[model samples]
Target chain A: MPILEVKNLNVSFKTIDGVVQAVNNVSFNVEHGEVLGIVGESGSGKSQSVLAIMGLLASNATVTGSIKFLGQELVGVNTKALNKVRGNKLSIIFQDPMTSLNPYLTIKSQMTEVLMLHKGMSKHDAVIESIRMLDFVGIPEAKERIGLYPHEFSGGMRQRVMIAMALLCRPELLIADEPTTALDVTVQAQILKILRDLQTEFKMSIILITHDMGVVANACDRVNVMYAGQLMESGSLDNIFYEPQHPYTQALLASIPSLEHEVERLATIPGEPPNLLALPDGCVFQGRCHKVHQECKGGDVVVQDFGAGRFMKCNLMQNLTNGINQGITSNVVVN
Target chain B: MEKLLEIKDLKVYFELKRSLLGKKRIVYAVDNVSFDVYKGETLGIVGESGCGKSTLARSLVGLNDITDGNVVFLGKDNLAKADSKRWHALRQEIQFIFQDPVASLNPRMTVAEIIAEPLNVYYPKMKDEEVLAKVLDMMHLVGLSDNQINRYPQEFSGGQCQRIGIARALVLNPKLIICDESVSALDVSIKAQIINLLKDLQKKLSLTVIFISHDLSVVKHICDRVLVMYLGNIMELATKEVIYKNHHHPYTQALLAAVPSANPKVEKHKHVKPLEGELPSPLHPPQGCVFSTRCPLADDGCKSARPELRYMDDGALVACFKA
Candidate 1:
């Protein structure tokens, strides 16, 4: 069984203007010991889907559908019961470590508190475990540095501390939301390497949410492309990178400047993302999609299964399938 | 190519707070950096944060005080020594597009007002109708609609706001425009749009640009020549092809290696060892090479003596003995 399964997850926020549908019918699963990447532009509801799973949404927000972990339904579960699982079996690392960590608390107090609360360990034992975890994440002199406040550490070091804290309980599933976005490229590379190594060492599943395609290519085994509030496509890493069927996914991949080759001009999808509150009647990406057709102008576009764990929500699938199949065969031959 | 701007031994220093012993320490932000930007070319300056790339850009526009250096614009005007009146005149030719789009723009001002602010200041005698026509022309050039001219910055999306920023920078028809990480804060698709617009504008206006960004991929896409800096020192200066293909400096190689490849196949097979260690505090940078502390090929020679930037056989300039 998969480590986590999200089925038709929808998240909406009630504001003064109206209801903002942040996430709409998003579904995906993270396999055991595999890294799943959720790629999207900002306001695409990628972060909200994970926030809903952790029960960390705002008070005015509403979440529907199901989030199951280890065959257990997490939606509508009481806060007390959810708390037992959160930060214990499932842990999260946010984008900015400075804001997520308490400024007033020392690293020792923050880390040991998690152990003492979740594992019921004594304070003395918690300190030892915390140091070991910090050491595992490559923080030199973890024993000495644990007493320092979060402000004392640099950006990269603070991110390492955040990772160590997230893995304090050796979580079965880890959700990292742009953990390295605030870091330099070299520091980002180091943090990613540490995460990759630790994920293997602990045999833990990871959900890496990012807007960077390079990061997704480097770290993820499977990719889910989100547009607006919907899942445009979902497949394995190779499938998503080399054979993207959805127009949004294709445009996104084409738009990013590549390190390997230089293009004269980057292909861009013109127009801003649609306002979620007053979304158009049909497909979420119809407004900006290059391959948008007549069928996408009206009625809801449903997710179509293409076997071998590939799924996409688009009306042009019937026309694209044969061409993509041939491309896949050619890709295999080239490989 | 004509030399649009020439920087000679530019250095910017900041004095730190006095120690408890009442001793003053100086931070060498831009330490003896010299380079030339050619006319009608996009020269990309890339480095990690705190590497003095932005400081170099600011020094050109007189935003940062030069501790010791010469900024010669058009081979005649030494901007560093220019008087206030001369500085005011030069500001019309060298405009800057800041990193943050929203924060850089005033919320109280409308888009038309924001774009016209430069014209009103530089060309005070121009009529309001002429200013409005110029502002509308710039807005149309940057792909913003005329109707949105009355809207404030908060009303537009990030990409549109960036267009306004670009329009403002272009209104004066500056000979040299400096973009300091202008697209770093944007999304991929929007970033691409802004990049394309900048390219088209550059071609149309024949503008000289100094593009400073930490994103190497974006730099590679838009820049004609690339300059790599480390700890306030120029590590490498070369054409984009040489920088990407035949890079000599160890720091340049490490910086390139650190960029994650967009292709999964390339990323999987990448064999270059990732760089180790973090940037040391600039307040007390290493004596020899700024990157010597983290360099994999560092030895006694590298640790003891600083390497001067020298021309290589491939026509690229590198500043490492090992290279």
Candidate 2:
């Protein structure tokens, strides 16, 4: 069985005005020890979908879905049982380090709290284990800095501290939300190296949420494209990069000013994302899509299996057009 | 090309009380940094956090008063006293686009109100109908619709909100616009959209833009000339071709390395070797070369003596001992 299976996940946020459908019938899976990347623009709801699966959605958000984690339904799991699965089985590393970390508490206090709560370790053992976790994420002289507050460390180092705190319970699955967004490139490389190495050693599945194609290409095995809270496309990394089926995904790839790309002008997706509250009758990408058709108004994800477990979703009437674009633009766009 | 804006050894300092006896503590935010913005060109000022990119920007725009040296805008020097009329004129000509859209724009105000605020202040005598018409034209230019005009800042997404910010800056038709990490807060796809919009606006308006950002890739995408700063000093300034292709300063190269390659072949490969240590605090900077503490190429000479930015070309300038 897959490590985690999310089936037809539908999520909505209850604001004062009305229910905003954030995630609409999205489904994906992560195999054991696999790194799945969910890439999209801002307000894509990639973060919300995964947060729903982890049973960590915000207080007002209403979720309707079947999330199976190691064969257990996570949607309706009790708070007590969910708490057991949260820190030990599944964990999250949020984007902003400054807000995520407590300014007054030391790394030792934070890491040890998770250890004692989830792993049920003694104070003495927790201290030792916390230092080990710190060292693993590359906080140099973990013994000395463990007592330092979040404000004492640099931004990159503080993120490492956050990672150390998350991994204290030896989670089976890690949900890293824009883990490298605020970091510089070299520091990003260091973080990715650390996460990849630790994932192999611990044999944990990972779902990285980011809007950066570079990050997705570097880290993930599978890529899921989300837009306006809908899964526009899902496929292997090779399929997503080499032959993007969806118009939105193709436009996203075109917009990146890459080293491989030689162009007079980049093609930006023409319009803004549809507001989650006022979605159109057609596909979510229809407004910005170049090859949008009447068939796309039906909201059917035309999926084609390219064998070997790879899948693609495109407009049924416009597959050949995107294919021709793939061949023509691929040469100029890819190095 | 005639330089539109020139900074001659600009130094901005803040003095604070340190002890009971009122000892002074000086924060050298922009220490002897100098550069020029030319006609219809984009100059990128890049540095990591606390390296004083925004400080230099504030100093140039006359928001933060300068402590030393002159910032020559057009033909006049503003370091000394300039009349209120000239100050107001400078305000109209030189504009700033802030980093965070959510923070920069007023949440309570609609997009039309936010964009019109500056126009009302700067063009007090202008007709109200004309201003609203121009606002709609600008909205169309930045890819926003007329329906979004009445919507509040919170109603739009980050990208849409930033478009409103850009439209506000462009409503005045300024010659020089200071974008201080404008795209840094956006996603890559959205970043490209904003960048493309800015580029389009720049060309159409013949804008002389000073784009400040730490990301080299973003600078590479938009700028004509790039100035690499470290610890409040100009380490290097060259054309994008020369800087990205063959950067001379160790700090500039190191900064370039820190931007993760969008390509697959090269991961986070250090360009000039790993910068040895963190950036020294601006409050108490190191002696001589500011980057010596974190420079792999530092020598004994680097620790003891400072290097001035000598002209490599008439255009390119580098301030490294080894360079």
Q: What tens digits encode model 1's per-residue C-alpha lDDT throughout A1-335?
A: 99899999999999999999999998888899999999999999999999999999999999999999989899999999999999999999999999999999999999999999999999999999999999999999999999999999999999999999999999999999999999999999999999899988999999999999999999999999998899989999998988887778888888888888877888888888999999998998888876678889889896778877788998874434632654222111000
Q: What is the clash count for each candidate, in the order shown? A: 0, 0
**Candidate 1 CAPRI classification by DockQ:** high
Candidate 2 residue-wise lDDT, A109-170, digit = tens: 88898889888899999999999999999888999999999999987898899888888888
Model 2, residue pairs in steric clash: none
Question: In model 2 chain B, where is the ten-residue run with the lowest total lDDT?
Answer: B268-277
Candidate 1 error regions (>4 Å): A319-335
Q: Give native contacts recovered, as a fraction, per prediction.
A: 0.80, 0.32
The TM-score measured for candidate 2 stands at 0.91
DockQ, per model, reads 0.87, 0.43
TM-score to native of every candidate shown: 0.97, 0.91
Pairs that clash in candidate 1: none
